[model samples]
Target: MIRVIVCDDQTLVRTGFVTILDAQPDIEVVGEAGDGLAVVELARRVRPDVVVMDIRMPGLDGIEATRRLAGPGVAEPVRTLVVTTFNLDEYVYEALRAGASGFLLKDATPQQLIAGVRTVAAGDALLAPAVTRRLIGRYGSRVRAADPPGAAGGGGANRSGLAPRELEVLRLIAAGQSNAEIAAALVLSGETVKTYVSRILAKLGLRDRVQAVVYAYRNGLADEMGEY
Candidate 1:
C-alpha cells in the first residue's frame, strides 16, 4: 500500500483529502495533520511514503516542512506532494526547491488527485510541462544575489562536459519537455531520451526533472532554451 499523510490547516479540506485517498484500495491514509508542525512530527514518526502538504498553515508553513523532510543532505528524504488552492501560487517553486516530488492544485478532480498520489509514490514528478515553464520563467532568476551562487547569469553549459546532443537534451529538459516529447522533437527513441535524462541528472548531481529546471534557470540556460 502507498501510505500517505495529509496535512492542511482547514479541517474540512483535510478530511476530504483523507477520504478520497483512503478510498483507493492501493492507497492508505495513515495520518492527518492540521498544520505544518504537526505534519512534520507525524511524518517523522510514521515515515509515510508520501505527504500531501498544504502551503499556508498556522505554524512552520509547508515549504519549511518540506525542506526539513526532503531537502538536500537529508538522511532519508520522503517524497512530498504539495497541494494548494491557488493556480499561480508563489510558494510552489520554493516547495519544489525544498524537495517536493510533485504538485497538484486542490481543485483537481478526485481521479487526478489519486493519480498524483500514485505518481509521486512511484517517484515521478507530477507537474505539467507548461506549468513548469511558466512558473520557472516567472520566479526563477540567475541575477538574484540573495538566492545562491555559481550562476554568472549567462553561461555554464560548456563546463558540464555535455556533448552537443546532450546539451540539446538538457535544454529541452529545462524547458519542461518529457522524455517522449524530447524524443519526438529530437527524432530519437523514447528510451534514448530516458538515457539522456539519466545522464544529465547524474552529471549535474540533480535529483529529478524539477531540479533540472531549476538548474537551467540558475545556470542561465533558460535564456537559450526556446519555447516548449
Candidate 2:
C-alpha cells in the first residue's frame, strides 16, 4: 500500500482529500494535519510515502515543510506534492525549488489527484504544461538568475554533467513529456526513457523531474531544444 499524509489548513479540504484517497484500495490516508506544524510532527512519526501539502497553511507553510522533509539536507527525504487552491507562479516555483515532487490544483479531479501521488511515488514529476510555462517564464526572467550555458562556472566542466542523449531527455521532460510519451517520441521503450530520465536527474543532482525541468528552462536548454 502507498501510505500518504494529507496536510491542509482547512478542515473541509483535508477531509475531502482523505475521503478521495482512502477510497483507492492501494492507497491509505495514514494521517492528516491541519497546519504545517502538525504536518511536520505527523510526517516524522508516520514516514509516509507521499505527502499532499497545502502551500498557504498557517505557520510554516508548504515550502518550508517540503524543504524540511525533502530538501537537500534532509537525512531521509519524503516525497511531497503541493496541492493548493491557488496556482500562483511564485508558489509553484518556490515549492519546486524547495524539493516538492509535484503540484496540483485543489480542484483537480479525483483521477488527477491519485495520478499525482502515484507519479511522484514512482520517481516522476507532475508538471502540467501551463504550470511549467508559467513558472519558467516567471522565474527565468528574474534578475541574478544563473546563466544556463555557463552555469557550471570557471572549470568549463559543463557541471550539469548530462550527455547529449540525457540532455534530450531533460528537454523532453521540461517540455512536459511523460516516460511513455518520451519513449514514443524518441522511438525507444518506456523503460529506456525511464533510465535516461533517472540518469539525467542523477547527473544534474536534481531531486526529481520538477527540478530537472526548472534547470532546463533556467539554463536555456528548453528554449534551444524547443518544446515537448
Candidate 3:
C-alpha cells in the first residue's frame, strides 16, 4: 500500500482529501495534520511514501515543510505533492524548488488527485509537459542570474555530468517533450530516450522530471522562446 499523510489548515479540506484517498485500495491515509509545523513531525514519525500538502497553513508554510522533508540535505527524502486552491506560477515553481514531486490545484478531480499521489509515491513527477512549460515560461525569468544552468561548470552542460546527447535530451525534456516526442525529434527509439532521461536525472542528482524541468529553467538551459 502507498502510505500518505495529508496536511491542510482547513479541517474540511483535509477530511475531503483523506476520504478520496482512503477509498483507493492501493492507498492509505496513515496520518493527517492541520498545521505545517505538526506535519513535519507527523511525516517523520509515519515515514509516509507521499505527503499531500497545502500551501498556506499557519506556523510553517507548506514550502518550508517540503524543504525540511525533501530538500537537498535530507538523508531520506519523502515525496511531497503540493495541493493548493491557488494556481500561481510562483507557488508552483517554489514548491518544486523545495523538493515537491508534484503540484495540483485543489479543484483537481478525485481521479487526478489519486493518480498524482500514486505517481509521486511511485517516484515519478506528477507534471504534464504542457502545463510545466507554461509555468516555467511565466516564472523562470525570476530565478537568480547567479544560478545559471551548469553553475557548477561556469554555465556549461558538463556541470550536470550529462553527455552531449544526454544534454540534448534534457533540453528537449525542458521544452516539455515526452519520451515519444523526444525520440521522434531525435530519430531514436523510445527506449533510448528513456535511457537518456534516466541518465540525466541520475547525473544531476535530481528527484524526477519536474525537478529536471525546474533545474533547466533555473539554470537557463531552457528558454521561454524555445520551440516545443
Candidate 4:
C-alpha cells in the first residue's frame, strides 16, 4: 500500500482528503494533521510514502514543512505533494524549491487528487507541463538576474551533468510530453525514453519531472526546444 499523510489547517480539508485517499485500495491514509507542526510529528510517526500538504497552515507552513521533510538537507526525505486552495505563483515556486514532489489545487477533482498521490508515491512528479511552464515563466522571469549563473530559481543544482539525450528528454518533459510522447518526438521507443528520464533524474539529483521542468525553464533550455 502507498501510505499517505494529509495535512491541512482545516479539519474538513484533512477529512475530505482522507476520505478520497482511503477509497483507493492502493493508497492508505495513515495519518492527518491540521497544521504544519502536527504534520511533522504525524509524518515521522507514520513514515508515509507521500504527504499531501497545505501551504497556508497556521504554524511552520507547508514550504518549511516540505523542506524539513523532503529538502536537500534531509537524509531520507519523504515525497510531498502540495495541495493548496491558493494559486499564488510564488507559493508554487517556493514549494517546489523546498523539495515538494508536486503541486495541485485543493479544488482538484477526486481523480486528480488520487492521481497526484499515486504519481508522487511512485516517485514521479505531478505538475503538468503547461502549469510548469506557466508557473516557472511567471516566477522565474522576475528573479532571473538573481538566480545563479545557470541555476533555476527552484534551487536545482547546475544541470551540466545531463547527457545530450537526457537534455533532450528534459526539454520534452518541460513541454508536457509523456514518455510515449517523448519517444515519438525523438523517434526512440517509450521504454528508451523512460530510461533516459531515469538517467536524467539520477544525474541531476532531482526527485521527479516537476523539478526537471523547473530546471529546463530556469536555464532557458525549454524555450529553445519549442513546443511538441
Which model scores highest in lDDT? 3
**Candidate 1 local lDDT, 1-228, one digit each (tens):** 999999999999999999999999999999999888898899999999999999888879999999999988789998999997556556888888788887888888999999999999988787767577777767777335234221223335333567778878888887777788899999999999889888877776667777777777766676677654
lDDT of prediction 2: 0.79
Best by TM-score: 1
Distance (Å) between predicted and true CA of 36, model 3?
A: 0.8
Pairs in clash, predicted candidate 4:
none
- Relative to the unseen true structure, what is the C-alpha lDDT of residue 185 in candidate 2, on a scale of 0 to 100? 82
Off by over 4 Å in 2: 143-160
In candidate 3, what are the lDDT values of residues 1-228, reduced to their tens digit? 999999999999999999999999999999999988899999999899999999888899999999999977789999999997545668778888888987888889999999999989988887766577787767877877455432243344444477778778888888877788899988999998888889888787676887788777777777633453
Candidate 4 versus the native: TM-score? 0.88
Question: What ranges in model 3 sit over 4 Å off?
Answer: 148-154, 157-161, 224-228
Residues 1-228 of candidate 2: C-alpha lDDT, one tens digit per residue:
899999998899889899999999989999999887888889999999999999988889988999888876688889999986554778777788788988998779999999989988877778876567766656754523353321344212443477777878888888777788899888899899979987776666666788777777766667677544
Model 2 clashes, total count: 1
- What's the alpha carbon RMSD for model 3? 2.4
Q: Rate the local accuracy (lDDT) of all candidates.
A: 0.81, 0.79, 0.83, 0.80
- Model 2 error, position 177 (Å): 1.1
TM-score per candidate: 0.89, 0.88, 0.89, 0.88
